[model samples]
Each structure stands twice: as C-alpha cells, then as structure tokens.
Target chain A: MHAIVCIKQVPESPSVGIDPKTNTLIRQGIPSIINPFDLYAIEEALLLKDKSGGKVTVVTMGPPQAVDALKEALAMGCDEAIFLCDKGFAGSDTWATSYALAKAIQSKAADYDVIFCGKQAIDGDTAQVGPGVARRLGIPQLTYVCKVREVDLEAKKIVVERLLEAGKEVVESRLPALVTVVKDINKPRFRTLIGIRKASQAQIPMLKPSDIGCEEEHTGLAGSPTEVVKIFTPEPRKGGQVIEGEPEEACETLVQKLMDAKIL
Target chain B: MAAAGTAAVRAVAVRAAGPRSRLKQRTKRYRLPNLRLDEENCTGCGACVDTCPFGALVLEGAVVRILDSCTDCGACVGSCPSEALILERPKAAGPAVDLSAYKDVWIVVEYDRKGVSHVALELLGKGRELADRLGCRLAALVLGESVSHLTDELFAHGADLAYVVEHAALKKYRTDPYVETAAQLIRKHKPEVVLLGATTTGRDFAGALAAEIDTGLTADCTGLEIDAASRNLVQTRPAFGGNIMAQIVCKRHRPQMSTVRPKVMELPKRRDGHKGQVVKEEVALDDEKFLTKVLEFVKEEGSTVNLADANVIVSGGRGLQDPANFKVIEELAKVLGGAVGASRAAVDAGWIAYPHQVGQTGKTVRPKLYIACGISGAIQHLAGMQTSDIIVAVNKDPDAPIFKVATFGVVADLFQAVPLLTEKLRKRLGK
Candidate 1:
C-alpha cells in the first residue's frame, strides 16, 4: 500500500489584515506554517502507513519556501517529499493548482493506493482542490472524512466516515481514491528527534511544469476560469450603545433592548 | 476579438444595475485592457477622465481616448452619463465561446425525511431574483430516492421548474454517482447558472461536478449578481476570514456555478398553493460502475452541532475565565432553547469541544440572535457571527471589539451580568 498526502503552507495566523491604502494583503512580517488542517492529513497518512506497512509521500504546490513545509512533514515520519515549485505555477487558483497536482501525481506517484488532503485550507477556505484533484484524476472522492474505519486491501477498498451537518455516514470506496480528512480524525503527532535529524539531511525532489508535462496556458493565473475582479476591505461594523452601570442595571437595559427589537 | 500586441477588448462593461460606487471592480493589472469608444454616444461629459485612477482615459476632441497605460479596471466605464465608455476584457482569457446556448438559472435542492433544507429554499429565493433580472426561468434540480414530494415545496418557495432524478444509489450522496448524473443533466440542458448551498454535501458535490463539467465554481459567495454587459454571474465572497472581499466572474464558462453559505441569503415565504412544472428524468446507471458505497449513518445524539441552523447561539470566550463558567452560557442557551458556542480561545483551552467553537476556524453562523459572553471580539470571531440579526455582548472591557458589532452591549462582569440577563429572559418568557 502506498499513501499520498497533499499539504499547503499557509500564513501562521488564519486572520489576515489588508492594507486599506494599497488595497493588498499585508504579508510582510507574518510567518508561514503547515496549514492547521493539513496536519491531520499528514498524520492520517502516517497512521495508514504504520498499520499496513507502506511508504507515505507528501506533495505541495507553492513557492520555493514551501520546501520547509515538506521538510516538516518528513519530520513527522513521511518517507518522501515532492516539491511542485515553478514560476509558471504562480497565481494558480484552485482549478489550476489542482490540475498541476494531479499531473504531478500521475507522472511521479501513479501507483499510489489512496490520496489524502486536509478538508480545507485556512487562507483560501475554499475546500475545492481535494475534490477538484479527484475529479481530474477520474477517481472517487470522499470529503470531510472524520475517521478511517478500515483498509481492506484484499477487497481493494477503503472505508471511512464522513462528518456532515445532518450526521455522520460510513462510506466505502475503491482503492486509488481520494479522501479529505477533517481535524476530528485524530490529534497530529509531534516531530521526533530521530525523524528531525533524518529530515534535515533528506534531499527533497522538485517538480516543475516541464517535468510534469503541463501546458503553460493551463497551469497559472491565465488558466483560471474565475477571476477576482475586485478586492476590498469589508465595511467595519459600527459600535453600538454600551451600558456600563451595575450588573443588574446593564442586564435590564440589555434585555429591554432585545424585547423592543422583538428578538426575545 | 481584441488584438494581442496592443490593448484589446475582452468584454464591455455596460451600465450598472445599481450605483457605480457600489459596484467594486477587479485587481489584476497584468494585461492591457482597452475600452471601446461609442463615438456616437460620447457627450464629452469628462466623467470618464476624472474617474480614471491612473489617468488612462483622456477627453480628446470630445471623445475619450484610452491611453496605453490603461489596465481596464472599468472605473471610467461607469462614470459616463451617456453610457459611451465600454470596457472590454483582454483576449488573454482564451478564445471566447458562444454563450447564447446557455439559458435559465438552476439550483440543486437537498432534502431528507424531515423535508427540504432551509438553504435550498434560500437559494431558490436568490435564484428567483437572478432569473427575473436575466429574464430566464428559475429551476431546481432534485436528486435522491423518493423526493418527488419536494417539488410542491420547491415551487411554493420560488422555483418555476423542478427536475427530479430518482435512483436508490442516489439515496446517499457519493461523489461519483451524484456528479455523473448531474453532469449529464447539465450538459444536455445547458443552464446559464447553477447555485448550491455551501453545506458539507453541497461543497463536496459541487467541486467534483464543476471539475467534471470543465467549468468554474466559486464557494460560499455572499452576493450573486448578473453583469448587465457580459450577462455573467458576478460572485462576491469573503476570501479569508472577513478582511478582504472579492467579486469573481466566470466570463467564458457556461453554467456558471457558485455555492453560497447557508443562512446568508434571505429565505422566501412559502405559499402552499404555488405550483410549477415537474419533469421526471432518467439516466443510465449500473451498480457495478459505482466505486463507492454507503455503509452506515450515525446521527449526532444531541442538537449541539446545529450551529448553522440555530436561531439563537450563546457563545463564550476567554472572558469566561474558567471552564466552569461555561455553565452560565449553557444555562442561557437552555433557557432560549438555542445552541452553545465557544470561541477558539475557549476551545483551545479545552473549555469546550471543537464542534462548539464559532469563528473563521470554527463555524460561520447567521443566527437570529447571538449573545457573546466574555468574548472580546477577535476579527475571526466577528467574521462568523457579525451577520446575526441581533447581537448582545456582555464583557468586562468596555473597549472590546465585540461591542462594535453588538446591537446591545453591557460592560459589566459577564459572571454577574449573564446570570441576571438569563434570569430576566426566563421570567419574561415564562420558560
């Protein structure tokens, strides 16, 4: 069994502030870390590897600095790392990004049994790429998965539980499928000393558009179908009247206001 | 077609349906975009000249001349009183496909034994408006086993047509069968726009469906509008948290798809006698072709996880000080028969479970009433609940940002204020 995990390096803080004057993201001092949700994906892959005795490979598409994320995944017991970095990949939206990742997987790791991705990235919060990649790969997708119930290699199938708004559903899909895991799946493990030492000396392989045999027209901002026409800071909510009297007085004022507003 | 070397026209920006200032335009300044001059309509009003942020438009001999510096931001297009300035998109977006084949607006409706979901009806309401504006029919795509009864409710809400496809395999949504059948229907019918709720099922199904159909899809859009000039769907959504709002458009793609967050749109009033057309359709499906299967379902014992649909939510934050103080919030929620929510800080401190957390990393809720106790409003937290109809904040700090969005704020100790507030509500409502 071979497990493939896709991860992203996002801003350390989920909350980003915009520069009102320039109308751009203020990304100067903020650090980058593994996306919070991707941690679960990486951990889930390693857990699958531990149970079935297979290798786990981590993949990411970003700038050169994204190698740090792959290295961190290596420190978490992943066997190999693939860095998808290139100028042509710049400004790729979910569609182009997923296309590039799918191309790389087809070229580099086509023999994998299952692919794992975090439910959604915090910065974009789109949750589209996992299913997008699955669609492009012509594979089955099980998203918002909270638990991996079983891996029946003999049956060539994987069973998992998906957490939905209404309830949880236990779903079974064939091998070579894609699963996007939520944070409730498991608590991610910390990097080990031995694993960190091995990661520091590991040579991460980098894949470019040419290596993946991707078309330049279909790999970047130009290839994206949906374009962000305008970006602006949302209007700030106006401060309301505040009552600062004793607890009883404030409570009475608040309740009366709710009653008058017919919210009660 | 717009020329390649020099500035070329992509698409024109006709007159706005609303005010110019209200419509925000795009940020990419890469390609040189040129506006077509309707010389006959030019009145030399000089509005386009002043509206150009980069001085790219100049009033030359009574007609505005677009300079080489123009990036086609469309700022000047709206300023022309005679509607003479028409901005066209750069041809780099790829060869323009004929969009005439696409018509009507459709929303995929989700339902269960309990009946249709509220978000589906909300989409119908918004879909009705968009369709009316575009002068097209509003339709609903209903998929599941034995869901024909939902057509009546759908029509009563807003849908003019209901496309029902039933199969036992579709009783539970698996990406493979659901996307396959929906794609088939969409390919044959070619609707101009498709809307879905950004629920777990909708998000899961939409991405795969859009990808399979080779179209663009926007997620959790807060605003959907029709571009008068291009007849495109302009989707506006909060990008990350709530700081930057981006308006997206699928100019070249047919069947423009977008998923809106539940409760974000207004739910239309249901008229029981309202009726519409119901078309029963069948598609080829073999059980052997499906690679996925549903094994079992486990419904959450309590209603604690229903934050998205909750009418009232009482959320606690670090202001609660200790985990035990969560009891006060729970007590209030019980009295109001609402759900209990917590801030990331409280959830991180192990005061409550992760499902109860509300914010950017948590749940984005649009409840009728929200009571924030001890929660100093973080931007992320505000992003989640600021849309609530009525907000009441109880915090010790008078300057907390939570007060900014609160409809009514109390700057007293939450421990003292919350119990009193809860007690008063209980007595007044006779609960």
Candidate 2:
C-alpha cells in the first residue's frame, strides 16, 4: 500500500492587515510555515503507514521556498517528498489549483492507493480543494474524517468515521480514493535524531507543470471561476463603554446591566 | 475566439435578465488600482492605450503610465502586446455563466427528528431580502427523510416556495447521497443564488456539492448582498484568519453559493399564516452508493461538548496554563448554569477535548452571556463568539484585545478574579 499526502505552506501569522487604498493584503515580513491543519494530515498518513505496512509520500505546491515544508515532512518519516514549483501556477485559486494537483498525481504519482489532505487550509479556509481534486480525478472523497476505523487491504477498501453536527458516521470507500482529515484524528510524533539526520541529507525532487502534463490554460488564474473584489475590516460598533473602576464596582455594574437587559 | 498570445476564457449560457439587468447605465464609485508599467519590458506599442476601457493608460517614450481611472480589470494587461503592463492580481478569471436561465434565491435547510436548526431560519431571513432585490422567488431546498412538514415552517421565515427532495438514504446526512440529491434539485431548478448555514453538516456537504456541481462557493460569509446593476451575489466573509474581511463574487457562475456562519444574520420576525408554494421531488440514490455508513451517534446530551446552542458559555484560554486551572472555569460555569468552552490553544495543550473548543476550527456560538477568562482575543477565537449578546472578559493584561469587544472587562488575574465574580453571581442568583 502506498499513501500520498498533499500539503501546503501558509503564512505563520494569519492576522494580516489590508491596504486600505488597494484593498489587498499586506503580506510583507510575514513568516511562512506548513499549514497548521496539514500537520494533522501528515500525522494521519504516517499512522496509516505504521498500522498497515506502507510507504508515505508527501507532496506540496508553492514557491521554491516551500521545499522546507517537504523537508519537515521527510523528518517525520515520510519515505519521499515532491515539490511542485512553477511560475505559471501563480495566482491559481482553489479550483484551478486542485486541477493542477490532480493532474500531477495522475501523471507523476499514479501508483498511489490513498490520497490524504487537510480538511481545509487555515489561510484559504476553503476546504474545497480536496473534494475538488477528487472530482477532477473521478474518485470518491470522504472528508472531515476524524478517525480511521479499519483498513481492509484484502477487500480493497477502507472505513473511517466522519464528524457531523451532533453525531458521527462510519464510511467505507474503495481503494485509490482521497480523504481529507480533521485535526482531532491524531497527535503528530516528534522527529527522532536518526530521522533528522536522514531528512537533513535528503534531496527533495521538484516537479513543474510541463513535467506533470498540465495545460497552461487550466493551471492558473485562467481556470479560476471566482475572484476577490475587495477586502476591508468590519466597521467598529459603538464600543468604548468599559465600566471604569475597581473589580468590585465593575462587577456590580455588570450585574446591574445584565439585569437591566433581562438576562439574569 | 481568443487572441493568438492571450489566454482563452470559457463562455457559458449567460444573457442579462430580470428587472435590474436593464439598468446598464449604472453609476458607481470604485477604487482605482495603481498599475505601474515596467520600462524594461515595454515594446513602445500603442496597443495598451487603445485597449484601456477606463482610458487610464498612455505610452510615453518607453514607459507606460496609468492614469487614475484604472479599475484593475486587467483587460489591457493581455492586450499590451508587450509584457509592460502588470497588476498584483492574476489573469482574468474566465468562466461566463448564463444569467438568463437562473432566477430564484434558494437556501438549504438542515433538520433532525426534533426540528430545524435556527441557522436555517436565519438564512431564510436573509434569503428573503436577496430574492426581493433580484425580483425573484425565495425558496428553501430541503432534502431528508420525512421532511415535507418543514415547508410551512419555512414560509413563516419568508420563503416563497419550498423544494423538497425526500429519500430514505437522506434520513441522515451522508456526503454522497446529500450532494447527489442537492445536485439534482439545483440542476432542475437552476436557482441564481444558494445559501446555507456554516454548521458542521453544512460545511461538510457544501464544498463537496459545489465541487460536484462545478460552481464557485464562498465559505463562512458574514455578509451577503446583491449588486443591483449586475444582479450578482456579493459574498463577504472574514478571511486571513478573521483579520481582514473579503468580498468574493462568482460573476460568471449560474448559482452563486455561500455558507454563512450562524448568528451573523438577524432572525426574521415570524409572520403567522404566510402562505408559500410547496413542491416535492424524488431522488433515487441507492443505499449501496453511500461510501460511508453512520454506525452510532454519540450525542452530548449531558456533556458540555456542544457549545453552539449554549445560552451562556464560559470559555478559558492558554492563560489558564495547566489542566488544573480548568476547575475555576468549570466552577464559574456551574454557578452561571452555562456551558464550558475553551480556546484552541488550551485544547491543543491537552487540557480539554476539541469538541469543547470555540474558534474558526471549532464550533461557533451566539450565547446570551459569554465570559472569557484568561483569553486574549485572537481574531480566530473572536470569530466564534463575537456575536454573543453580552461578553464579559477577565484577563490580567489591560492591553489584551478581548476587552475591546467585551461588554464588561475585569483587568485582573483569572485565578483570583474568577472566584470573586462567581461568588457574587452565586449570591445574586441564589445558586
């Protein structure tokens, strides 16, 4: 069995201010890290590998600097890492980006049994790319998976539990399917000294659009269907009504205010 | 047909429609983008000057300068002939969906054996206004087992029509069955806009359904509006982890869809005896098609796991430091008779389960009284509970941002301040 995990590098600090004039984000001086949610995806893949004897392969698409994320995944015991870096892929939205990734998987890593992704990237917060890639690949997608129940290699199927509003559901999918994992699944393991040594010496392979059999038209902004027109902070409510005084006086005033609003 | 070097865009079945589409000569005010042309890449061509729709560009010697009327549509970027003109944004997002065929505004309804969720009602309240602005019908699309009875309830919240797709497979929410059923309804009716609550079920199903239908969807929107001239749905939401709000639009798509967080919209006043149309449809998805089965439901009947519906929630943060510090929070919640919640930091520290956490990754709540102890207001944390009726923050740091939104703030340590507040509340409420 071979497990393929797709990850992304996102801003370490998500609290970014927008340029009031241009209505665009000011991304200067922000550090980058592998998306927080993708850590859970990596851990889930590694656990699946440990449980059922398989190799884990990690994949990420970003600027050349994103190779660090691949190295981090390798330190966590992934067998191999692939970095997808291309200038044409810039400005790709979730829809077009998923198309590029699915094409990459189909052409380069065609020998995978399962594909894993974070439920959503914290920066984009779309959660659409996983299912979007599944659709582009014509495969079944089981998302928001919190637990892996059973892996029946003999039956060429796997069962997992998904988190719902008030309950959980046990779902079974065929082999060579995609699953988006949630954070509640597992705790990631820390890197060992030997693993760190191997990761430091590892040379991650790079893949471009031409290497992945992707078309220029479907790779970037041309294929995207939606666009962000403006960005702004919400208007401030009539704030600054803080009751000034000692703790006791403030507590008494709060209680009185609560009573006036009929909340008591 | 696209030009030789420029990228091509897909054309859909859109033609202007409805009452407002005829108002083509609309006046508007918009911020112009500053586009600086690179002299190194300039080819001394006049093509861009002719292609500028806003008349904001001119070629001077080898440098091209943009005037103030540049709307950043990037139309001239592709026609520049030379690679001199550039903007920070990407190429034109090219998919033109037909506006003539799609009409009504539709909201998806979620319910259990008990009844519908309040978020569903809240969507209808907003959906009514969007439909009215578009001069179209406001409809609620419900798919489940034995859910036809919900049609009348939708009418009370301002739905002009109820579209029901009933199937036994939909008795519980499963991704495959729900998306397939919803796709059938959407393809048949071709609603112009679709809305849903950003609940667990909605978030779980909306993305897949949008992908399946090949439509663009914005998640967790706090604002929705109709662009009068274009009749496009403008969806706004907190992005960049709630630090900045972004307005997104699928201008070329037929069904502009978005999932909004609960409590962001006002609940409409219920009008008794309001009549609306009810239509039922059948979706034939076999049980075998469902890749997953619901084995068992673990409901938080007596636990504090489900904080979304709590009338009052007392949440603690990493300021508590250790697992033992949660006793103070639990004690305070016990005194107030409210549910207990935690920030993502505390939950990640192994002090509490993920279910009891509130933030962008956890549950969103709109309790009447929300007390934050030792919680500095991260935008992600505030996104979940900022809508609470009355927020009381207890933190030792006077500069903590939590006090900015708190109705009442106590600038003291939680370990000492919480017990004092609890005792006073206990005495007043006779706990």
Candidate 3:
C-alpha cells in the first residue's frame, strides 16, 4: 500500500501579524514550522510504511519555502515529497484548500491507497479540511483517529480507533480512505543520518493547477468563498487578586468568596 | 449567450499562456466563473432557499438560480442536497461592512430547565466591560417560553436592555426554528457583538446562526475584549492541543460572535430592582414546519457535580496510582465541597474518566482555587489550569513545574499528604 501525508506550515507563535490592507497573515518575516499536529501524522505514516513495506509521500501546499517542510518530512522517512505551490493559491480558505488538495490527490490516484492528515492545522483549527477533502474525493474519512488496530492488505480494509467525545470507537473502512490522526496516535521517530542524506538529495515534484486538472478559479483566493475581513488579537485577561493568608484562613476566605459570588 | 461564451473562450486562452507571462496576461484571467449548478443532481429540497440569508438562491422552473447580487458566503453549500450547489468566487468583491452601522454589544442569555448557564452571565460580565470601554450599551437576547419574566433578572445582571424572543416553539431546544428565530431577531436589531455559551446547544445554534448571517464566529473562547484601536471583538481560544492560545477577530462582520466556556469568566454582581426596556417580539413558527421532533427528554441520574462549573476543584494525578486509590482524592474533594479532577496520566491509566482529566487535550478550566495533588505539571497540563485564580501544588518532587504556578507548594508524598489533608479538612469542617 502507498500512503500520502498532508502537512502544513504555520506560524510558531500566537503573535502572528496580519496585513491590514489584505486581511491576510503577514508571513514575510514570521518564523514558521511544520504544524505540530502534522508531525504525528507523518510519524504514523512512517510507522505504517515500516510494518507493511510501502512508500510514503509527504505533500504540502504553501509558498515556495514550504518545500523545506516537505524535505523535513522526507528526512523523517517519507520516500517521496510533493509541493503544490503557485502564486494563485494564496489566500485560499479551507474549502478551496481541500478542493486543491483533492485535485492533487486525483492526479496521483493510481499510486496511493490511503491518505493521512493531522486532525486539524494549528493556525486554522477548523478541523474541516480533511473531511472536506474526503468529501470532495468521495472517500470515507475517519477523523480524530487515536490508534491503528489492524490492516488487512488482501481484503483492502483498515480498522482503527476513532476518538469521540466520551470514548473511542473501533471503525473499519476500505482502502483509499482518509484518516486524520491526533497526537496520541504515535511518537514520531528522530531522523537518522542515512535518511537525512537521502532527503538532502531528494527532488520534490512541484505540481500546479494544470498538472492536477483543477480549474485555476477553484485553486486560490479567487476560488475561496469565505473571507477573513479582519484580524486582531484577544484582549489580555484582568489580573486576579491574590489572597494572602494561612492555609486554614485562606480556605475559609475562598469559600466565603465563592458563596458571595454564588458559585459555591 | 454568445457574449458569455466568448468571455469563457478568452478566459481559457489567457489561462493557456505559459508561466513566463506571469504578470500581465493573467490579469484578465483572474475573474471567477459563476457558481456551478448541476441541474441533474439537484433534488429541489429548498434547503439552499431556507439557508440563504442574502436571498441569493431562488427556484425557477424546478431549478435553483444564483442571483446577481450574491455575497458568495458559502452558507448554502452545507445545506445542498446531491451536492449540486457549489460556491464560486465572484469576479467583483462583495460590499464590505460599514462599521458605523453597528453599535451596542449583546450577550445571548441561554437558560434551560437548569436556569441560565454560567457562560452567558460571564459573557454579560465581560460585555459590560467592553460596552463601557466603547461607550455603548450592553444588551442580552433572552429567548424562551414566558422568558419575559426573566427580563428583570437579566437587567439586574448588567444588561441595559433585554431583547426578548419568546415563543412556544422555543420551549425546548431545536435547531431549525431556534436558528431562524434568532437570526431574524439579529437582523432586526444588529448588535455589534453577540456572545453565547460554549455548551452543546450553544455551539450547535451559534454555528448555524453565524453561517446564516455570513459572519465569523470563534468557538470555546477563554477571553474576549474590545480592541481599543479598531473597536473589534478580540476573541481568544486554545488551539493545537492547547500548546498555544490563539486570539481571533472578525473585523468586517457585524455582531462579532464568540462562545465562552463555562467558568472561564467571573459572573457579574447582581443589582436588585434593576429595570430595563423589554422589547417582546414574536417569531413566525408553525407546527408543520418543525422538521426534527423531540420524542422525549431523558435526564441522566448522577451526583450532578458538573466539574466544568466547579469553582474549587481538587484534582489528582498519576502519583495517586490506582483507580481505588482515587477515593482519597474524592474524599478530600467531598470534605471541601469541591469537584474532583485528574491529570491526563490518571485518566489514561483508567484510574478516572476522561471528563475528570485536566490538560490541553482535556477541558480548559479557570476555577477560583485549583488544588493539584501529585501532579508534576507538563506544559499540556499547565495549559488547562494555569489561569486559575489560586493554585496549590502537592507533590513529592519539589522541582515540579506545578510549583512555579502554585501559591503554596508542599513537597510531600500524595499518599501521605492527601489523607492528612482530607482528615484535616474533615475535622475542620466537623464532618
């Protein structure tokens, strides 16, 4: 089985600056890293590759510099990497993003049997893209997966544990399915020297809208329906009053405060 | 038809130009196509009609047509059957909101059989501050059966006005009717900021309402403030497994919307005999229009100690070891009349349920006093309780990160410390 892992790069800090004119993230000088959650997805894919003897492909959509993130994923044991980069793809919302990704997946449909993604990107915690991509591709998607229980290669079926609000449910789906993984899935392995050497020389395939048969209109800001008209940070919380007293006295005082607040 | 076809052919020709002509020739190719409608796949369910707030969709000759002045907000996409309708970006941008039209801040007072949820009142408290800062009025949108009786209560709790939407159809929580009623009320009186509780019902309702209004909404927010510079609602929530806190803003949309989790803010002090204008509005609702039926409402039986609402929480950690050993922590919690919480380690070990876990993956809490028993705080764990008013750490390791945030740090084994603490509290309380 061949697996593809979708990853994204996001700002490392919460202090992301937005361009007032465009209402878009100002990424000119901001430091970015592979979305932390996607790391677990890459790790899980590599683990599956190790057990089943399959090739893993890491794909990411961002500015040209995002190729570095794809290279990093390759160093962690992915066999190949792809970058969906173009100026037209800028300012795409989750809906348009998933459309572009789904088109890219269709371009490589013959090779891949399973697609893996982090439950949600850190910068945009909508958790909608993976499911959206699955919907666009007309494939079954199991989100918030915590563990992979079994894989029947001959039967072309995979069983995994899905994380629900109360507990986990064991779900079985066919091959060519999409699974969005959470952090508890697995601990990612560190890159070895051999893997680093291979990644340094690896040539990442850059795919554009023409290569994927996607209309240029559906790939970028032009295709995005939702818009971020404004961006701002939340106000700082008011500092709480510190109660200084002995343990017994403080406990009594706290209880009285709760009662006064009618919260007790 | 000829002119439209010629435009499409020209678009194709321009797009066919190579990457080298990246700057100039692409200008004409930037225009987006009309929203695609697959007539064969359309089920004519009228979902897009009801869901479209801007009146963008209309059925003509058994087919839906996109109107010329559509905003392309994508609200109709979720409601489409056979996935026939798709949102296509317009060649020209939609009209942007003129912020001067919006004025006061509003908080939706969400009451049920259990009375008003804490987050509503918390938002009211927060809204009061923002309204004061912006020199605007703070109003509460109260909707329920005979809810006008609670208008005085809403005014007492800091609401300058109570916009009541009372109806028999709203007696129980249902999605379609409630969203329609609330959205209509919002359209009638456009408040600059609208807040709701992050409870199950609130999340469901807020998502639909925001989608209907074609606005932005930040969910499960821990903080809210008015940007002194832009007068925008700055909503903050935990993201990425609570690794970092993200502050979001809906600048262009009116009624900057957000949902605050319970116990994240302080409830406002009530002023007795406070009076405010109660505007009663009737939402058009018929018996046949209600699609989803509520067969019955079954209340779960339990001790009824909602940890999310608990002000004082006594949480245990892995050092407690076994499921049976958790009884000591519970005893101590019971003695103090507080809810019992647990670290993710304990929850994963099956010593307690996941709801009791306090961490990034678990619930974000800001209780008045959080007692950490044997929790060697990891960053994930700290993300949940770091905002507590008073933290007391009890663990054998003196260097635990919990000590950094704890008001009083006791370096003692939880096995010894917890039982002793429980006995002391029990004796002190004469229990």
Per-model TM-score on C-alpha atoms: 0.85, 0.82, 0.58
Query: A8-83, model 2: which lDDT tens digit per residue?
Result: 7665555444445854344433445567777888898898889888799888776444566677787788888876
Residues B147-184 of candidate 1 have per-residue lDDT tens digits of: 99899999999899999999987887778888989999
Error of 1 at B110 (Å): 1.0
Better of 1 and 3 by lDDT: 1
Model 2 RMSD vs true structure: 10.7
Candidate 3 residue-wise lDDT, A1-264, digit = tens: 798898886544322333447443332223445666688889988888888898998877765445557767877888887777664565465556777888888886547878898876644455556756665665566667778877767787788876543245566677777788876777778766677667666666557777888888665656554443322322322223333454445455544554455433
lDDT score of residue A200 within candidate 3: 65
**lDDT digits (tens) for residues A92-208 of candidate 1:** 667777888899899889989999999987767789999999999999999989899998877888999998775789998998899998877888998887777777677765566
Relative to the true structure, candidate 3 reaches a TM of 0.58
Collision pairs in model 1: A229-B25, A229-B26, A230-B26, B10-B88, B10-B89, B11-B88, B11-B89
| lDDT of each residue in B110-199, candidate 3, tens digit only | 775566666777888888998998899999888777777777778888889988887888876655567678889888888888888876
Tens-place lDDT per residue, model 2, B241-341, is: 56556677887777988998887798999998999999988778888866666666766565455576667889999899999999899888888788899
Quote the lDDT for A112 in model 1: 92
Decoy 1 TM-score against native: 0.85
> What are the candidates' individual DockQ scores?
0.26, 0.27, 0.04
